[model samples]
Target chain A: MRSVRYTPPLWRQWNLVWNFAQRDLKSKFKGSALGWAWSLIVPLATLGIYTVVFSFIFRAEPPDLGNGRDGVFVLFLFAGLTAWTFLASSINGGISGLIGTGALLKKIYFPPYAPVLGAVVAVGVQSLIELGLFLSVLLVLGNVGWSWLLVPVWAAVFTTFTVSLAVIFAVLNVTMRDLAHLVTIALQLLFYATPIIYPLTLVPEHWHSVPLRVLIEWTPFSQFIQVFRGLTYGLDAGSWMSWLTMVAWAALALGIAALVVRRRGGDLGEEL
Target chain B: MSEPAIRVEDLSKVFRLHTERRSSLKEIVVRGRSRRAGSFQALEGVSFEVPRGTTVGLIGHNGSGKSTLLKILAGVYRPTSGGVVVDGRVSALLELGAGFHGELTGRENIYLNGSILGMSRREIESSIQEIIAFAGIGEFIDSPVKVYSSGMYVRLGFAIAVTLDPEILIVDEIIAVGDEEFQRKCFDHLFRLRNQGTTIVLVTHSMGLAAELCDTAVWLDHGHVRAIGPAPEVISEYLGAVNENEALSNDEPGMIRAGLDAVRSGSGEVQVRAVEALDQLGRPLPVVLTNEPLTLRVHFDVKVPVRDVTIGIGFIHENGTGIGGSNTREHGVPIQLEPGVGYIDYTTDRLDLMPANWRMSTAVRSHGHVYDMLEKAFPLPVRSSGGSTEGGAVRIHGRWGAAVQEDSPSTAPSAATP
Candidate 1:
């Protein structure tokens, strides 16, 4: 089939994404009494447990570390968790969407990425709702402003990055079923490696030096959280260099994913 | 536009089957050492066009390229080399509920399935009430579809497709999804869609349905175009092929005699051929069924071993599921002497079944094994007409039961338990 002369309009694609997200949200809490309210209650309960453990049981005190950055500890946790959850939830479904829907692939063909795109958007929409609750907590304590813009910017970068990663996983998962298991391990490692519980400054000075700091700060994953942190504290996200890095990553990874899917999409249905 | 709805020129598909498939890691390691695998040519140089607002039937054997052609048109599989240009929007109900997400609720899935089939949300929103109403699954519409009975789910899905009303609709098979009533509803809905100027492409196993519904038919065999045009003509040829195959494998000596019992072949019923008994050594024996060693010894003159002679048999329970049988050529035994003369034999060493309608048939196989049949014996009735009938077909060897009271009320002179 020849690619149509008209480039695929975003609105049509976005509509598909919307329908999938609607189902994703409704399907998640479909049978329950509260339904989607579980999204709010589960996280709130997790926060209660964390507050009791760190603030009460341990009798820990907020560090007299720095300025506004030091006070936004809960925000840091939520910010990191928000981006991390998006990645985590997405990898689970996105990588396996094609594998899971082998029945449809054998019969009806659409863009191969349709399932992954829908699933990512579905999980992303759910995470945004969770993000809103965390943002409300921040508002109750103080004020939230420019950080919101950073959230969107980071979201754009993170989505592109995660989507690319998801595409690669999708393509690879069909041939190498091991990719799904490997992605799970990778998500686990990223959890502790990133500064979710503590500030980026909490790492000792020697540990954060030169290349080590550069590695952490320059990572696409780091940008996912860094931009959000920068927004919350009303700080700048480095210079044009970070934007250049993000754009380059999104372009390269996406290009690679498209190439893999296109070259191999023909035989994929048979294997699936 | 009055253009034909579907068009094809030299449409063909070739599928490659590797001798052995290797994992990605194995491929990387053995790179240049691996050899090319065997391939299969499923379809080649086949082409047909259905005029706008027409229904076309596709009939073929199980492995026929009918499905392959449909999939390419559905855009699921691209042809290895060839082209298919459809002039209007195409919707494939290749399988009922083919695209439904199990986790999604009935209401949410309606919107999803509707859009996937090309309905705008606004269109779906307007039809949503009608669709739910037609589906007849009241409050359960809000429940996840995972819990829906297959019949209910397919009904809802078919409702969405019919309501969408695309310019072209392709259905792989008729409504095998639901009960008879539901299937009739699907047919009625499809008939309505057909009248509304929507071109339909149908692939089905039922000749009656195809002949009644489709204006034209395309007969495919291992990807080759066997016949094209008029549904009745194409279906007739398809059935002819099926009858030929059945003839090659089904025959028996004196089998004609089996078709004629006094009860069935009475009066105007066809004449019964030689009936006798036999052994494994082509010798004679007697009394069959439930551990009696028995056989048939052929005897008689075939006024003519008519060009279309089919001798077949079947063991059936009252509820009707056929047990096995074999024939003359099937047993690798020959029919004797020539057209006007015949004497041969066969046997049933252990007739493992009990009493039931055991039907032995004789017919003229009209054609090869690709179609429904012509039965000369008219499904012969084999059950004992009277007292000899005692047990079920399974031969359970167990006693029957009855719950009768020993009240002796008459002896007590009209008694009521008060």
Candidate 2:
């Protein structure tokens, strides 16, 4: 009999993870006539609608680029939306990961996190592609800067952070199905609460003596968007405090995710 | 020598049956605390060891925990309170195509499924050709599996599982699917694996298959181990208990009426009581040896006087294919019946049947009108003295001879004259 380990190390299961991720990516556009072009088209369409609503309708002022040129409001919104879309889709996919692959889990023995991580990686790849297209648009607009080198570094950190959150929510969603619904509502609220659509300058320093600016600045989504806009839109590496905050958030979420998985993952097969 | 391949100690699994299944927060809040639902133990203190290089079969009725035990062994389910130590790598075929995606092509699925089974990418790449050849689905390997027939799906699943060459293989009634030829191929592959000393654990309803393949059999009944011993002995004990339960059920008034109306239909004159296979010395034989004289005796209770009665018997293969049959009228034998109980014997000089499981079907008719008919009323197990190399339902008896022939019409007469 083959010995089974309930939680195999991620490095050992890399191939399996890659296979799952590939399957997910392929099936996303499998039979469609547009194929992978749809990956680009869907986000472009979303960016177009958001730009029209916030830039033209709301008359939001655009931030200045590091090249000392007037930043296009569409470019400013695209930078923030890229990071926001990655976070939203990764968490959503993670929430459904275990429930969707319940049939496979009941038949075979592998680490429960493989599918969850695979889903995160699949979305991560799409987000990277979207980032690439956004950078190309910056290149065409002559808004490039040296700080853009840190974009890959920030993306890696953001992915690790996303993975940790995905794992925690995936494991939790297995026991309480209402978690998914709650998460969907929470994400919709968080989108507006963060600086994805509106400029951070619009809000006062304090609302009812609450110090609302500091509160919004520390929200993980806001911190991520701040660093993303600094790299591609503002063309600066942002502040060390923001970088430290991103790393700390990733580390904290990872610790909680590990604890959640260790406690609840063993009996997942029975629950399924 | 070395330790057994698998050692399961006092394994138990209890499933909590949630009556209301309050997975929503609204229900939890409205109902206060989530009430503890009733729990049913699927497997209780089940202990067994499968020796290295030997096969063990789990046999039981549905919901008897055979499947639960297999899953626990496969590591798909963890035992509640017991420890299961497996010595080597394990591959379980709990369900064919368990991880298959409908949108993926057959080749893509193999890569994904193989990796899920713990094969490295290189290992799957190395054996991809062999798996495709074994499935025999031709160019359909490139087509998405959703479009393939169910047989093709099962074939590909079985192919990938068997080719993995794990130290211990776990299977659950997977061979029951597919055509006969494919089933034979699967058996041949399993036989080879057993010969190569791969420890195997199988769950199957076919006692004949269990007897043929397993070294030992474990019989489970209602979360308890009823018997564990040599394959044949344990199977016979299980079958005996099943027959007893059936007889007990038949005694119920409702079941008796239903049985008379469904399984038995005839005129209200003669009613068949029982069917038995007996040895030449007139003793009830549960298993008959090949080429031995045997008799099928049919007992009947005559409710009214009858004449020109014909008692017939038919041998049906376990697959429901009819082997052959005969009636007293076909042999020019006539019988007169009156009230009271009696039995008619259909005796044969030699039973020329290969080693396989068969069923006996009997009927009584008079004046071309049915009297009592019982289809597949009794099981007949034929065992060869030793393993036979032949296939199919019946054994053919003939002599092998050779004759040298010359290239001349007159001289080749001996070769042509059989």
Candidate 3:
């Protein structure tokens, strides 16, 4: 068998990513006190914190029309957490992924982007677990919708978007150690600036608000929530614009990340 | 007749060294940002080809580009200005345990390291048992590698590598590590590999080892090919060069000349009337193993000197470092002086040595210093091996301690009378 490191065809990039992804997923619980359960626990704790902050401190109540179901609000929050956490963790760790596996980079003659790909894949697995938790909550709360059928599409788009973004960060992290913090904080600001927890309808409508509204919709997290809300709450995507923007962002991120990895891959060892 | 298994042409690699360290802000400013684009030239125009089943040993001093050349051939590092064509599957044990994850279980790491060495996942799975058995890690294979000692580390790495069965194998200095038993096992594996018609490239500093194992050898000096030929011939030239370089600093010119003349005439049963170290100008003096253009001059009035009396200097090492001396008698230098005053000067090009104390011995006889025994001196401090021999080549004049290890010593004091 011929050993490879993307020297053959570009299609092997996916295989390289998958191989490294397995390594990353294996490392997550490889040495933990609770093993794989840690993935489920952190999100459970985070959900509890948000519930206390939003439900008790603010005493925030969802809009009701003589109905005793606040499941919509809960699903909204859960969906946001799922999308945000996956992208944030993957993107944040992706930058330093090479630095973390510095020894491997110098010793092994494989694709340099493997570590970062592995990290994102690990986060993808975590997101799936989180989705399981989210589903159970939806089932218990008794506010379910037929729109859940579209959830997989939304998740796929967002997951792919997150992975592409992570690839870019992993390459950048090789040269800039601080980029890990920079990307995480940038992603955090994105979460607040988007409509993850907030409803878009709450904003005052204005024609001159076109650019602002478009920018908000273009965010992958927002795009995910938009379609997710559409599926769960009987909300329909008003235009095809959100889908185009999400796809365009993913393509662009992937393109640039691939180029960077291809050109300066050999430098990863030196940087590490 | 067939195409060589591995070929390299004009291979050269230049590393841009970044030696300055600045972890803290204060230190960064104190050291100032600096980078020197110094080229190490780990391999320069090093052209060679190895037919199938040929074992070629690379002998060189440290930093002579042996490792770099091996890395490039292993495909771990891309050559800076040349190309290589390898015709078969390659497994390079550049470093053992390089790809193992300490946090992973030893069994898991076996698969991981194997894949890194170009073993497929299926291949690794199939070979896992053999790897464990060969490593002798036993049930500890289930334990995380963080708990492993260095011996275990080498065992696992080597075990995984040996299972790969690559058609072409490139070995760095890995055989120098581990216990002697493990080293012997490695040799057995290499021997089997060669018998199976696998081509191997070995980089080592031991000339004797190369001569024994390699079909041919190459001498690398600072990234350039100094010589390449038969294993024994090339290795002897390298050893001679290494000694001459070391001898240059601590020896004199005249004594080396006289010794050379004495050896040239050939000798038998020669006795020294006078022995002196010489300056670079061939003047007699009292130092041994000095710098370039120097020698050891032995002036002797023979009582019963015969035909072809051999006189030569033999430097003795107590622990892997050379002490200085030369006599025609020991080195097969043939000469005969019938009850006449005569002198022999042994000449050398240079003295490549580090600082250390050692023993020097000189002897003289007939027929290349092998026929009859004569005078020999205690070794004095001549040069250091500079720790380059640390886990490396065996020093000729070195001493070795030995003991018959007891399996279980009888305990008398702790035993109470029955």
Q: Which of the numbered candidates is closest to the native, going by highest lDDT? A: 2
* After superposition, candidate 3 runs with Cα above 4 Å error: A1-27, A30-32, A59-71, A139-150, A202-213, A232-239, B17-40, B251-418
lDDT string, candidate 1, B169-205, tens digits: 7787754566879877877877787888888988887
Candidates in descending DockQ order: 2, 1, 3
Interface RMSD of 2: 2.0
lDDT of 1 by residue, A197-219 (tens): 55566555455455555566667
Q: For the second chain of model 1, what is the TM-score against the true structure's chain B?
A: 0.63
Misplaced by over 4 Å in model 1 are: A1-8, A41-69, A143-147, A202-210, A265-268, B18-36, B251-418
Question: For candidate 1, what is the TM-score?
Answer: 0.72
Question: How much lDDT does each candidate structure score?
Answer: 0.66, 0.84, 0.67
lDDT per residue for candidate 2 within B267-344, as digits (tens), equals 758887776667788876655667778777778899889999998888888888999999889899889998999988
Candidate 1 chain B worst ten-residue window by lDDT: B364-373
Q: What overall lDDT, based on C-alpha atoms, would model 2 receive against the true structure? A: 0.84
| Two-way TM-score contest, 1 vs 2, winner | 2
lDDT of 3: 0.67
For candidate 2, the TM-score is 0.85
Docking quality category of candidate 2 according to DockQ thresholds: medium
